[model samples]
Target: MKINRCIAPLMISVILSVAGCSSSSKEDQVMNANLGAQALYDKARESMANGNFAAAADSLSALDSRFPFGPLSHQVQLDLVYSYYKSGKIDQTLATIDRFIRLNPNHADVDYAFYMRGLTNMEADNNLFQELVGIDTTDRDPSKSKQAFDDFRRLIQQYPDSKYAADARQRMVFIKNRLASYEISIARFYMRREAFIAAANRGRYVLEYYPDSDQLQQALEIMVECYDQLELTELRDNAMKTLKLNFPDSQFIS
Candidate 1:
């Protein structure tokens, strides 16, 4: 009986040790979590270089969680933004950039963060119908374009000497033109509907807000047409005279 009891205890001990060994390996396989932040970041960069944005994001996110206050935290956030953008996680990208900007407003790379924020909105606001079907649906709401324009404008104003300033300025011009053209389209639509007052107001808005836009002459012509349709002789005549003075050879004047 003593011999049997000793043998039973030995068997139980072996079984427990074996179970512990299995659990350790199983835990490693089940989680597969990286141990070191730097190593994980290096792996993320390697994934990024190979165009594996999904994996790169995963590694970056892991590193971020594990080492939020680490020296590479900001860089990880920036890289994660790029990775999320590449992987089409636009919301995540924007959120990441915004957090970075809020946290590191005076960082050397803050301009880049602002530029990326603008780019994100610009891409989001793209006229997909116009690009894909060659249709000019300019009457759509310009809210996204306005947001992008604000972001780009802030970047330019705050970082005039930044490398991204020139591009931000150019994008602002494009957004302004788009917004002006959209206002014109709305004005013309109102005119077709015989809502002459609304049409005139829209034209005036374009003229006042988008003076430097290419649509300036069109705006003047729209105001002239709407005022004439509404029998506002004085306003119509004033708009016509201004158009003639500013654009003597404009097709809109005719």
Candidate 2:
């Protein structure tokens, strides 16, 4: 009985191992059976031209898996990122971007990947429904916005003269404004709850980190009000003076 029990476990293990190998072999065979690298790339391009991003992604993924180091490898990775992004596969787009950036950091076109990373993260922060409904996202989590901002910042810093640098700078401005606006929203909420310290701190953060934001005036106003509430006369006067100097026509000037 003991011998039989040991043999049974051994046989089961052997069978499982064989099954795993067979599964992997099948996958390899399928990859091999696909069109040649060039043909597959052409197919993906055609699909992309037709606005069939899903089909293009499939073909490009298959090409990438079958020919990881082929002559078209770099182009395949770039195309895969674009197709995945167009297909709304944010995770796949990011994974491919990370892989490309990791493997080809010094490639001439790496800046495009960085730009696309920012664009993807920005897209992830919004949904079609939210756009259609005109929902207020200022109070929503800003983590994705922050990530996008970092991506664009890195692109600008590393590829200052890249073709996409101008657009990246523009997007960075927008992201800073959005982030500052979100902070102001939080500060306003804290003010409503009589959390003067928290409100003033948020305003201070915007002033310190996002001075170029369009919400600078609002942040200064909030800081002044919060400091007044907390009886911080010096801080209130400083904030008020800054607000007045910057925004002479501001309603809060008085």
**Clash count per candidate:** 0, 0
**Tens digits of per-residue lDDT for model 2, 1-254:** 35587699899999999999889757655764667989889888998999989878988998999899999999999999999999999999999999999999999889999999999999998768877899888888989999999999999999999999999999989989989999999999999999999999999999999998899998999999899998999999999999989998988777
Per-prediction TM-score: 0.83, 0.86
The positional error of residue 70 in candidate 1, measured at the CA in angstroms, is: 1.0
How many angstroms is residue 48 displaced in model 2 relative to the true structure, after the best TM-score fit? Answer: 0.4
The TM-score measured for candidate 2 stands at 0.86
Note each model's CA RMSD in angstroms. 12.7, 8.9
Model 1 C-alpha lDDT per residue in residues 40-79, reported as the tens digit of each score: 8888899899998977897888888889999999899999
Off by over 4 Å in 2: 1-32
lDDT on C-alpha atoms for all candidate structures: 0.88, 0.92
- Global CA lDDT computed for model 2: 0.92
